[model samples]
Target: MNTPLNLAALVLALSAALTSAPALAHGEAHAGAQAQEVVKEQKPWGIAGDADQVDRTIEVSMTDQMRFIPDRIEVKLGETIRFVHRNQGRVLHEFVLGTKQDLDEHAAMMVKFPGMEHDEPYMAHVGPGKREEIVWTFNRAGEFDFACLIAGHYQAGMVGKISVSPTN
Candidate 1:
């Protein structure tokens, strides 16, 4: 017979199944035991860019102080940019691009699930003294955010801004 407890358990099971796969894959990748392919999905800010279409290259630094050097960046809509990430700290850092709300939600998830992992075209997981890159095409004209959502990093203020202006 159907009951409230069963419904609650069903909801909980569904949520865990939907969310845990990516986190599990991320954990494996984080441990350097496997490689996860870049997930391709169109986002409000833009989509995964073709390396051959990159119009510019921007270098960003992730420091131990929870800061991204040159925290603000401006780009023209429709331009493809190759962002090079340099991790200068002794710990691991991430560069995740998304809307402010999306980032805030993800940050909260990170706080609750410290091992949460996600790999996409707009994110880069960089280890200390390591270098990584994200090629993105800013097809939308608006403001977006990039942050390091690793447990206390986001709460400690590890974030940056990207302003995309219309091309016309």
Candidate 2:
């Protein structure tokens, strides 16, 4: 029973258990852990803004039609925006902000793991007839994307754009 083959099997089992511990502790599974961890770092789109320093507040409404009312938003670079999200639909929705590439990757992950839960400063999850808000400082000047990455939502055209213009 103490053969080399048995020892190798035991080592592999232990290695998998050890590696999965952290992911379970964080309530994230596999690739989901990587996605949430990436959100904690600074993104090229911008960083989380302080609520007290909010330059303006924009109200966004989500509906069952798989759309965000006023899907286009423009802001000046370095402006802090408090985005108030209202879910007017009969189902759940989420607003996630990131670069187009990041959004695309995250959306794909969402398709694979529909139950994955991630709470970042750039994301607001709202249930039916619920309200949520996220404050973000657009310090970069470029075109970014915001979307509802709940399984099929993103693919249903539930996406928005944010244009950050360089400050004069």
Candidate 3:
């Protein structure tokens, strides 16, 4: 029944969560710090959105199989979206929004620095049985990507797509 594979996956998940323990311990302050660090750079995806400005909310779920339900999503340019992520599996997961290149670069970084802590308006890290939300405005018209860059998760194909329709 692939017990060894299952055990390996569990170990990876626990390790991922443990690595973020220090940042999580400080609550939102550390999260805020991470978000600020990311914000200092130009966002290749979209800008952070105000909660009151969200045009709609999308519900997404993550599983231990390394997948996001409804992996493809569409939105209009200039529209703000609130992503509601639920971690239904017995592992840690994160929702990070970016362009394909942005995601790829970040994935590579995750492999090098698994315990690296940083956040942005477009990222939400969730532990098992928990939920998190991120609001973002799709100011540009292009295809973006979302992924879980937790150690082996991204390599296991835990990713999603976002399409922003062009506006005149």
- Please give the distance, in angstroms, between residue 116's alpha carbon in candidate 3 and its true position after superposition: 0.4
What TM-score does candidate 3 get on C-alpha atoms? 0.77
**Model 3, total clashes:** 0
- On the 0 to 100 scale, the lDDT of residue 46 in model 3 is 78
Q: Which candidate model has the greater TM-score, 1 or 2?
A: 1
Clashing pairs in 1: none
lDDT scores of the candidates, listed in order: 0.85, 0.84, 0.82
Residue-wise lDDT of candidate 2 within 111-143, one digit each (tens)?
Answer: 888777556778888778978777889988999
TM-score of each predicted structure versus truth: 0.79, 0.76, 0.77
Show where candidate 3 strays beyond 4 Å. 1-42
lDDT of 1 by residue, 84-147 (tens): 9999999989898999999999889888877765556777888899888888999999999999
Better of 1 and 3 by lDDT: 1
- Top of the candidates by lDDT: 1
RMSD of each: 8.6, 6.9, 11.1
